[model samples]
Target: MHYLLPARLDLQAHLSAWPPTEVPQFHPDALVRLLHLVTEVPAHNRKLAKQIRQQGGYVPLSAQLLQSIERHYNHYLTYAVRSGLLETDGRWWPTTAQVAGKCRGYRFTAAYCTPHPDASSDEVARQPRLQLVHLTDPKMQAKARRQGRRPTLLSPAERRDLRLREQPHAPLLEWLAPNRTPLRLDQAAALAYLAERFDMLPPVVAPRPKWPEWRPKWLKALDRDYYASPVEQYNQRLHSIVRLANRQLQPSIDTTVGRLHTTLTNMSSELRPFVYADGYGPLVSIDLVNSQPYLANLLWNPAFYTKSSSVKSTINFQNFRQSEIYKGRNVKGIIKEIPDIMLVNISQLTHREDIRLFSSFTGSGQFYELLLNAFRQRDVTLTTRKEVKELVFQVLFTRNGYYSPYKALFCLLFPTVDHIFRLLKQQDHTLLPRLLQALEAYLFLHVISRRVARTWPQVPLFTVHDSLVVPQEYAGQVEQIVREELRQATGIEPTLKHEQWSQAVRHDLLPPTSVASSIELNKKNR
Candidate 1:
């Protein structure tokens, strides 16, 4: 009996020409479904609609995406467009063209539905209830099922799915809901300040240089996969952040990797200054310096993996190596020996000078700088810390078979560490990033956030991956706690950096000509 329908009426009556039994053209429910879809971006939420308007107010619609919902979607869409119920905008290009087919932006015509004017609280409450699209009719339900669509939202499972789509995950929902401990946002004030200055900053896309034949092979793959340039991607993310701010609702949250993904985390570093912790006033973010490399240092110790939530392998190293040897594996050849060779390497890990140096670099928060300096020494094309960091990530996260001269230099510098990285990726290339992210989530979410909440019940806490966001007043105490927890967990003193969330991005703070320069400038300013 449960169904989702548009809150307002479609005054155009676009499907009136078609009879109920019509075929190969418009169905009786065609207009209703199209209205349902066209209005789907805002979903009857006025705040969401206003926010979406900041991003040009169009919904990206593709024949491929629509066809996934039903087979005859094209005809239905064409009918709606010709009937003047819908209008098309320019083509929508996503980050990658391969992941999605051609998409055309679409929005509902004013003839389709009347816009609701801003009303007072009493007037809003007095408004009529949303009209429901009931599939109580057996024929309608059967037709929906035939199209591989949901027939009813009556079931508990269906309702649950709907709720999830409307709100955030359970734990994040509890934190965001209207309560004493609400995760508040001073969005109205923030957006007003941001809107005045955001458009002034021109997009600063980096120039794409032609790939030299002698360049690293992985660079080719990376460039090929990314359809848009760095600045274009940055602008895209910036617009999205602006749209998110316009909502003025509870910020959306994702519990992916056990981390809270709010608008704060999603926005560019340049835009971070405008947002605050609502009633608690201005906030500060304490970032874990060289988070990934620092976390990877833990992998050097065999005992860490057993205790890690993401990687809990208790296999005996000696037995594992013996088994590999017994299976006629080439034990003498390091690369061909075993994927779990890190286990065997742990015995002599402490003796390696390179391992000790790597630990020192990560601990002192100079991992990226160290790589940058080394790449510069080798006269590699990389110039900034950002480029060096990306190169290192590609090497660490990409498949072991991926060829790169930069990776070769890394191997030359830290033979033991590079060997461990190759061994870790032998089984699955994705294991490294996934394991590191999981460890990061455990460290920040389970360890730091939990400890902070337990100690200071009044302080509002949020997370941006490896970093922790709290009010400025409690920063020192929180920093101390973070330091203690990290050292206790990893047995290494980590370098932590703090950045305050301000109300504006100053003139000098404007993004520079290239992403690399912008990053370097931001680092220096921080």
Candidate 2:
């Protein structure tokens, strides 16, 4: 270790000569405003964005703060969700803060901005440039420290100082896809076909209100008549108690025990008063700390909400009809059905179909039909068995590395794409059973033909779900086969490929007929 030791005085002098580092633009008010937005008892993303937007006068917001705002809002929205601050059907919206300003932390007040009202050509000629003054107010710095936010934007010099401070960001890199696609499949066509063949999957079930109840005086409610409620928490908890009691009351010839909602009347004292959601239109709910259901936020439902085009939250409102609870106590005892075997099977299948279609496919129709349609237009010409194996390999372990993320080649080769992709995270292992199932099914009823099931000597083409990549000249032949096979498998008549898919499909195939009906968007699936 040969180092120069006598240079301390010179080093100190040199350091003293360096310019001061620039501070990021921070204001005391920003932190205060943000705290008000976020800690709003039950912080919400929409509410936060809205609040920011409401402060019409410019606030010094920055990109960093905006990002934090969205992040924290999401955090609190999740909180409100778990706390039952919202109803079972409640949704989140942005607070006013998110949209009002371009930068999240940078604010432009008349004082900070140039004196010129407008910066036009003449203003530019006047050399009217405004200089930014770094803030040094101790109070503002203290506020920034409390909120765990950076006091100002980091200039190059200040950023270097952060390095000196020993905090650093994670290294970022772009992991390449290696080979994405030279040819493409029509996911839209596939989804549409699937939706037609199989119905749209059922969404999550939520409890609704029962029929109207006689509004008793507020004092009378507290007094508790014999028929009055004793609070209970959660739908399932109430259900279990009611069901057990119903078993006790079972269609018997007792003196006087027709026990309708008997268990509901016996809830814990702390929970009974909040049981009435009938008067409230729609409320958002959160689950427990363990993700179990608990009531959350309640929003006033507008008569107009039911008509929105995109049925995100609107579906909750529309679902109120089938729900007996939504009808309230006045309509409770008219009639009910126990649900026989046929209905139960039908319901289970319908729900499963919904989940598969919704989760497996993105952007529309259904899952299975899309597969049939896409295969129809594809040219599956196979000279030998090698092509099939290659195709299968491409589908399964499509990525070059062991730890690579799931890729699109997944569409073609692997059958259990979902299972295989997900299982990568686990230490447990399994052979490609589901993939075997999918391939066996795909291979069983299918063959290369001019048209589907046409049984040509040469295997001309194959389909993987809804994607079909075939020669332009073979479009007509592929189209005919797709419709025939689709009908054969699903029992639904097939529509034109163009009608079923995105209009912007790079037509390697010839154009076909168009049908007037189908939602215009029902676009390409994933």
Candidate 3:
């Protein structure tokens, strides 16, 4: 059974004829936008049209103008398909069914030919064609009309209200390719078990938690909903987790905005504990400690190299690996101090005595507390350990030569660590955040994911950026494997932390009530 797949149409040739007859007014800007939407990005036809209309400035595209444009667009497709210039299967996946593995619409095969008037026949024949896809379905046409009637933009207040009402969830629109290899039997069973448990789980109905007083002003301004009621925010996260679990699980990578965003990776930390494999016990999460800063330290370690002509050595590298830093410190304590020590070393300041004093404070392994005390001494109004940690993150994640607006605060807090930011930008023109992200992806996909697949083939391992969630029994082995992989990949010893489901459950940390119960309570209260 052969399907009549759509071939590309030569619209440019028809439009560029010597004396054009009844060619529709297809604006160049509109055509370009349409081509981008269909071929490159690949959105639904109605969505593509709405996006084009929304782009119009001053006065938005009028209903009549929009209708006319869509009409011409549809007419072009119809004519091309009918005349055999363009081909199609004459069938379409319904808009509702498109999410369920029916993504195929009209695909672009060839370009529209715009022959030069002075050019020979050979030149005309050699004209390159544009490859594009077009959707020509009655349902899509109806959807477009409905969407046109809807308002495109919302006021700030309306947007805030909408955010409050709707659950905050990343879109789970990506579908795995059908031709991709299937998951192993064990892997498939584990995923299926997790999916079932996730679907059956109830929503959380907990007491509203206090908002963090030390949250950055900028972050507070951006996500008011999160700050307003942390418990409600958590409930929304639970709903998102359920939705993510409901998605089709397969061994395929889905990328968005140059980063991997697969269904498993997108699961929030709050929801990870609830994930379970049938035969294996509840999941445990093991994550790299201070992963981004660790990478940055690795990148800029050479800057601290000493040249005495007789013998050359790096002070930072040697100090970092020394047991003296961890003398009284446990893993967590050592991890917490690494950022501050790295900052002091990387800054390349002239005041070596002051740097040494700051290093002593960091080496105390109570960096955040001491840093907060230092800020208080300088009259810099920082309250919590979290706030100090956020400040450290702000410095570490700063991009290519661009000083954060919070520079004054950071400089006042850590007076001698200003040069480290400049050195990071000098080391790489590309921003540290992007470089760190690429490295993280490489580490997760290449090292961690592969190791899990090979060593514990039956175990259901999931990734969340720098962390991996696996069965609790295998947590120690997984952590060891991850550390070994990181050492092999970057030659840096990695610090690891684990969160067990048993611990969380024993502490009554997981939300006590199910979603259905929460909904019922809300109804009763109303």
Per-prediction TM-score: 0.57, 0.17, 0.42
Ranking by TM-score: 1, 3, 2
Clashes of each: 0, 85, 10
Best by TM-score: 1
lDDT of 3 by residue, 315-361 (tens): 22333333231223132132232344344544345345544444445
Give me the overall lDDT of model 3: 0.42
* Ten contiguous residues minimizing lDDT sum, candidate 2: 290-299
Q: Poorest 10 consecutive residues of model 1 by lDDT?
A: 120-129
Error of 2 at 89 (Å): 70
Candidate 3 deviant stretches above 4 angstroms: 1-241, 244-259, 302-370, 373-379, 396-406, 409-420, 423-430, 485-494, 502-526
lDDT of all predictions: 0.55, 0.26, 0.42
Q: Per-residue CA lDDT of candidate 1, range 1-526, in tens? A: 2232334553334345533332374444544555555544454233554434433446656566576555687666666577665666656666575675446756655543323232222211111112335444476555654543222212464345344432223332334333333333344444454445445544443333333333344455433322223323333343434334333123432222334455456566766666555555566899999888888777776655343334343222232233221122122132233355554546468679998888888998888888778677878777787667766876777798877776787888889888887777888786677656756755676557777776665566778889988766667778988998777666679899999885453323222324453345335534
- Which is superior by lDDT, 2 or 3? 3
Ranking by lDDT: 1, 3, 2
Error of 2 at 34 (Å): 74
Model 2: residue 492 alpha-carbon error in angstroms: 8.8
